[model samples]
Target: MDIEYIKDNYIFEKLNENHNLDDFECEIEDLAKFLKEDAWNQQNMNLSLTHVVICDGIVVGYVSILTDAMKLRILEDKETKDKICSKLNISENNVIPAIKIGRFAIDKRYAHNGLGKHVFRNVMLSILDISENIVGLRFITVDAYATAFGFYVEKHKFKYLKKDQKDVDSLNKIIKIDPERSFSLYKDIKSILK
Candidate 1:
């Protein structure tokens, strides 16, 4: 279960208790704290899987993913829906299987070094490999932060999950406190594997 990757001179490994998370500081204060304090506990509880990027034996970045399900309607476009259904061999009405990038961040020192793209690509590639054998996984999704929206949408080619008025209204209601903003984005796994 140790998913490892070597890219852009960094080694990626599953974040475990042995990895030093304390010094890993990303731009996002919450993200840095979560990786340092909570990721291990969440991993132990079967909540999500977190992977760290190591450069010269120092933990500089991490990405977390969870095996999850999405409603078929979560897709923004008909073509994406069709592609997913064809891959899973299920109708459009069926709930789609997915993996979600729950959290991702690179240390402040590594920002603008093109490391984020490398780490993101590795995460998607790992999910694509998992879907081939796991039978149901058809899409990779992310609740993207507002600032990183363009990175996910434009750079990574992740499509925004079209939200209806009702959906937006509900999300707005629940997100009142602190008002953290994010947009749901998805990419068809079939396209990635191709």
Candidate 2:
């Protein structure tokens, strides 16, 4: 688990038909299952695009991303909404283009090193490139697990999406599976605007 070695050696490659994911495990069952079983199928379905960090023909980490749009009105936390408005210089009643990190996980073996943060930086960098060239995306969103709260919020500056009652459907579905689910969280791209 040499962080510098990984940084110098690992390459981000699009998940493809030839890749064998049998040994990829992040110790989080759901995340591992999603990568090994669902990622390719979902990619074929145009649901999400997955990328793997490979080093010496092994998968060290992976992330799945997809297009997302956030309706500003759903940001019920007044302070959060106001901050977003002031930073992006926009009203709080329109749709803001975004990209969602559908899934993000690092291998269990790479847990304690700086690899997770390194991989996340790659994610943001890739999104920034896309934002500059392909689209004018304004935000980044994630359905963060409770265990990931500190990682997304404190470490990465993500804030909870404080939607009103109208956000019940998605909340309910997540809550049904894990009662401690954190619902949704977002990072304003304006903070890192190019």
Candidate 3:
């Protein structure tokens, strides 16, 4: 699997093939709704740093990072946010930099190819690279879907904070996975970089 960071609209459009949302019974309209009002935003454009995974040049899975503080605040609560800040060791005056992973859809055909791990590793690499240059980055956060929470916690080692029951209820009503929460898996990028 090849993970490429593509900014082109065409690449973003290709995420529909064997889309992850479809696995969760989410439709394009639902995605549009989230993007319109719920998705992250930064500097006017959606606050999504997207990564596309290709098998033989075909887009299979994709992941996005929400780096906008305002948008993140709207999604997570004050306590959860403070925990993330503590993990990153940032002062209150500094802008809270976070990495929210979304759109982690893998093509149904490529389910067993380990593409998910590849996509995650690439995203972490990018986040680490960016955090090295930035001053106030404290934590990498995700409101991981219930289906994906185990993978995030067990495989990725992200510590679960409090859950946003309201958001969890609104999104996955029947799944009955624990309520969605904020998690900070990687706290210090600078030390790792050095």
* TM-score of each predicted structure versus truth: 0.82, 0.84, 0.53
Off by over 4 Å in 2: 76-80, 83-90, 163-182
lDDT string, candidate 3, 89-119, tens digits: 7544455556556556565554545656655
Highest TM-score model number: 2
Residue-wise C-alpha lDDT for candidate 1, range 1-194, written one tens digit per residue:
12233354687788877887767787768889889888899999999988888877888788888987778766777887777678768886787778899999988877766778878888888788888776567778888766676688778888877674354446545455433577888888877745
Lowest lDDT sum, 10 consecutive residues, model 3, at 1-10
Task: Give the top-scoring candidate (lDDT).
Answer: 2
The runs of at least 3 residues in candidate 1 whose Cα sits more than 4 Å from the true structure, single-residue gaps closed, are: 1-7, 83-91, 164-179
Per-residue lDDT of candidate 2, residues 53-156 (tens digit): 89888899999999999988777457767887888788988788999999999989887677888789778888888898999997889987766666877678
Candidate 3 lDDT for residue 97 = 56
| Model 2 alpha-carbon miss at residue 75, Å | 2.7
Model 3 residue runs over 4 Å out of place are 1-44, 69-95, 134-136, 163-194
In order, how many clashes per candidate?
0, 0, 2
The true-versus-predicted C-alpha distance at residue 164 of model 2, in Å, is 9.4
